[model samples]
Target: MSDHQKTEGDQSATQDSMRPESPEAAAHPRRLKSFVIRSGRKTAGQQAAYDTLWPKLGLDPGTPLRDSRSPGRESAPLVIEVGFGMGQSLAEMALAAPETDFVGIEVHPPGVGSLCLQIQTSEIGNIRIYQHDAVEVFEGCVDDASVDRIQVYFPDPWHKKRHHKRRLIQPEFTAMLAAKLKPGGLLHLATDWEHYAHHMYDVLAAEPTLENLAEDKFVERPEWRPETKFERRGQKLGHGVYDLLFRKR
Candidate 1:
């Protein structure tokens, strides 16, 4: 079997044992409180949906967070898409690949609500979600060598030169992601900002633990990615979009 297939085989063998206990099982139950405790930050329309749906669809305070069940089909491969704005691409990709499990992390209320709605309306059981900072999620919850793929689509470019420090794709953060991914695992990133793309290439290239999968420039956009309205607007304005794929070495 290829290395990817072998990883899946190992995942199946350990799925059951890796299931986490409910949050109530934690030593301090109150610590299990979700970062999304307040919906007030969301716009009225977003809050309305969140109020109506989160209670029913949201995971109980401490339900085992990751999808690790391998009953009928092997638990679909775990793929995490961060900053999935409004969940357009996330919902489309999950529907396109039912065999792949997905976990989405977003801090924006409207986006979180939209994704939750998609997960519910589509009857997609292969996905789960969390409302917290992506950095904390990687550092605290996700296990080493547990994630198969990590996707970051159009993170805020932090356009101002001084604000570039705030961009999500950085050496330190990429290193953290490398530590989280299984060997040979994939990291797929996209951005419309040319400067940001070059910055990403430089940062990733410097990382000895990862290998760039693309030869010359960024690869052609994958068919599976949904062209968001923002991307469309970018195209109309002459801004180019870049996709970068790297494998953990």
Candidate 2:
């Protein structure tokens, strides 16, 4: 892969390899991670951002957010976005909604650092981050019936049938995600892969509590979600994007 591609994917590698949640989830990771965890060092800007911005913007694994609710900023809509690679769109959303508290969960170190840099450059204060497995963060850190919206955009398709099991939008994981939502809380997902979009729809449709927001089960990309350079590239390549929105019932 090109260095640019290696350092910054369109989406974060937030896939969970292990199916079950355990305390050792962090200790033992990446047996069959859905996306390639590209190996590299953080850029100078990213490293510098880590030094200057991480203390205020970073969140530790298993930090209980339900009780604290972002260090004295309570009563704001709590939005958790999984796999926010490079954080361009996530930062835009945070800037757009100053009244909302956004918590981004990404598994890549470069992504974490890059987003820290975005937070600094954008000068947005409503965003915090967790540089850890998305599944583990959802399982342990976020409390049930607490989140207002959850976003998972363009997770790896795992296109091969044999590797489909590693795809992040499995039944078990969907249920766990739905459990974290408050009643009427929304879950928004988008993907360029057709089959993977359907797979996501099937998994989320099966969840007992989530009601599909669209009558057709897919919706147009909302204005709140900014198109990333990666997504624009995909669009130019004639890729069709599908968005699925569901709300806890």
Candidate 3:
């Protein structure tokens, strides 16, 4: 098996150990998972970076963030991004905003490995990573009302009607995310799928604690977010991208 395949198998084994125990527990409506582990070969450079850089850049998913120090400056605002695929845009944002600290949550091993490489090569100090489920990390590790901003960009559309339940922008998760943000903290989301964009807008709008940042239900993409390769590809295919920004009220 390739290194990536082995890594994915190990992660799945670990997840299995933590699965609900009893048949009743299992039958109690399993949480809708937003991702599937897809194995890809990890490059030697990525593996090396994961080995060397992870000690300094990785965060334990079970550890509470209240005890952790913010990268660079203690007073720096903490920005957390969910599912930062390949970490390209995340690395760019961290580089551009050196005064702000960033926390990225992703489950894919190759993406984690690639981000480790980026952190090492760029000598980036303002970002940390958690290679685990974002929902679990938020609930178990992050302190209430502690985050300054939350970003979710280009999440899986889960386009099929039967798969809509698996989409990440659900109402319960939205409320939980809003509660994690301090009053006035921002939640920013973007998507190339119009259906998913509308879904996100409806979910966020339903959260009474969050106030929309745009006059319209959707907002134009902000200047701070770097144009990602996936986004460029979507544009080339004549896809419309929508951004939504909301603040905790």
Best-fitting candidate, scored by lDDT? 3
| lDDT winner between candidates 2 and 3 | 3
Clashing pairs in 1: 23-62
Best by TM-score: 3
lDDT of 1 by residue, 2-102 (tens): 10122233343355247774676555433211122223255666567677667654543233444333466444578887767678788888898888878
What do the candidate models score in CA lDDT, each in turn?
Answer: 0.70, 0.80, 0.82
lDDT of 3 by residue, 181-236 (tens): 99999999988889988999999999999999999889888877888777788799
User: What's each prediction's TM-score?
Assistant: 0.75, 0.85, 0.87
Query: How many clashes show up in model 3?
Result: 0
CA displacement after TM-score superposition, residue 122 of candidate 3 (Å) = 0.9
How do the residues 71-152 of candidate 2 rate in per-residue lDDT, one tens digit apiece?
5677789999988877888899999999999998776678778888888887889998887777778877888998999998
Best-first order by TM-score = 3, 2, 1
Residues forming the 10-long window of minimal summed lDDT in candidate 3 = 1-10
